[model samples]
Target: MSLFNKALASIGIGSAQVDTKLEKDKVTPGGEIRGVVHIKGGNTEQKVDEIYLGLNTTYLKESNDRKINVPVVIDRFRLNEPFTIGPGETKEIPFSFVLPLDVPISIGRTKIWVSTALDIKNAVDPSDKDYLHVIPNRLMDAVLNGVEDLGFRLREADCEQAPYRLRKRLPFIQEFEFVPVMGSFRGRLDELELVFFQVSENETEIYMQVDRRARGLGGFLSEALEMDESNIRFTVTSSDIPGLRQKLETIINKYS
Candidate 1:
């Protein structure tokens, strides 16, 4: 009977199961995430080799002139060591980690989740998944507010395949698109795209692409050739928020 149960467990008929419970489902970048992993033993004794938790998100990749969604593991953590569980036994492990500062917010088509896996030697492993909603950090929030203060409204936001020059640890980047509704450059600019490069508690680096409104035949030609856009790189600190609108205005004027 024991041999039969072990065989069944090995084949996943009655293998151990795993479930993760998070303290909170919503968090901000550079924040801590706390969770617990619950494991229940199967019908027979099993030797658990290790347990792992991974942060997962999707990114776009171009292939054959088509965009394909690909899964990326941003970070991972090993939670436990080898252990033994008897039939019907249960165990719980608590975990906590700080999310990366540049993690993209959960907006639009972008999604982020945590996955937990139980590894059993020569047996089927069970796993659990928990999704999370990531919000902007303080610095990022300030920057966004500054943009709004400059009379630009957020038009769209999404995570897409990063350009070569901007590629870092991840293969994708989050873009915040905005258009001036009632600003000095409202009539001169078509749209503005902002991408955060590095974000910290005190400072952040930003990349701005300013699209100028087309004028005549030359302007139309430049637009078709991607020459109508100008890219600018700048860094700002917490103290810069107060004058951010004016600073951005000056930058846009230069490009316009």
Candidate 2:
């Protein structure tokens, strides 16, 4: 009976299982996440080689003129070393890690999650998944608020394949699209696309694409020539929040 149970366990019929419980489901970028991994042994003894946790998200990729969803791993953490788990044994491992400052916030179709895996020698690995909500950090929040203060409301937000110049550790970037309702940019601009880059604890860089509304014959011609849009890059610090609107307005005016 014991031999049969061990054989069944090796084939994952009654093997160990893993579950990850996060302290909280919502977190901000650059914040620390605390969690615990629970492992429950089953049927027979198991030799666990290691345990790992990974941060994963999906991004859009273009292939053959079509966009397809592709999985990307943002980061990974090892939670344990080799260990033995007797039948019916249970263990809990505590864990903590810092999220990347540039991680995409969980908005629109963008999703982020933590995955835990238990590696068992000569047996199937057991795994668990827990989704997380990533919000903007203080600096990013301020910048977003500044944009809102300028009368731009978030129209759409999504992660898509990045251009060569914007590629970093990941092949895709998150874009926030906004449209002006009532502000200095209302009449002249059609929409604005914003992308954050090189985000850190102290500072971050921004890329803006200003799309101008066609006004007259000249404007229509410019639009037809694909010249009605302008791209700008700027850097901002936490202190800049006080005058963020003014700085952003000035930059927009330069292109207008």
Candidate 3:
């Protein structure tokens, strides 16, 4: 028996096993996830009371000057009928569900983890977890276009704890970074970090942080801005290209 099987055997109920298989290994938000749940009976025939699927993720929380692991449940599904399995009988269950577009993408690959388990009376058997990657749709493209048009290039992207409580409903934030195109300011700004929330068909909330580097004489200057359920993501426009270029010269004249 495998280590997992041994662990399950130690629980004292008849040994049970669970397996999960997904139809599409990759998907985008607003996509559907379809899979099968396989269950095997143990030494004795058992009354399989129920089965369930959990969409879970690990998030970070900061308090007391430190961060801690926090598990969040995005959604859950349960079987309504009780089935009986003969000794050593194998059973398969089918499942499919649509993923919410706003769901946070995993650290790397929008791939979220889905865990499935079975219940035999009070005994529980958990299957090995599966990872499914998600993609962002057209809405994401529209948002990115605005940023790129504003002289920012994609630098870094990741899911992290929201820095503030301004948006209470979202558990994770995606940060995108961009550098000022050549000759944009007095000194080159490091990069801009962006966060999006309340994403939908019509509008999305945007949060921006500008990282301005300090030079010889001037105090460091930086600004943070937030937008709630609005599409005002771009402040500088194409028409401002000429004036924006001039502003960079002044920055150099003043400092460097």
The numbered model that scores best in lDDT is 2
Could you arrange the candidates by lDDT from highest to lowest?
2, 1, 3
Query: Which residue segments of model 3 deviate by more than 4 Å?
Result: 1-14, 107-111, 145-155, 168-170, 179-188, 201-203, 215-218, 221-256
Q: Candidate 1 lDDT, tens digit per residue, 59-144?
A: 88898999999898889999988999889999999999999887888987889999999889878788889999998777788888
Off by over 4 Å in 2: none
Best by TM-score: 2
What TM-score does prediction 1 earn? Answer: 0.94
Q: What is the C-alpha lDDT of each candidate?
A: 0.89, 0.91, 0.61
List the candidates' TM-scores in order. 0.94, 0.95, 0.69
Rank order by TM-score, top first? Answer: 2, 1, 3
Please give the lDDT score for candidate 2: 0.91
Per-residue CA lDDT of model 3 for 1-256, tens digit only, reads 4555445554745666788899986776667899888888776555667788878676667768997767666777885488877657898888898877566655443347888867665455545688776655555555565556556667667655775664455576667766767444314565666666544434455565655565443333222232211212333333434454353334323432
Record all residue pairs in model 2 with backbone atoms less than 3 Å apart, i.e. clashing.
Answer: none
Query: lDDT, candidate 3, residue 39?
Result: 82
- Give the residue spans of candidate 1 off by over 4 A: none
Q: Which ten-residue region of model 3 has the weakest summed lDDT?
A: 222-231
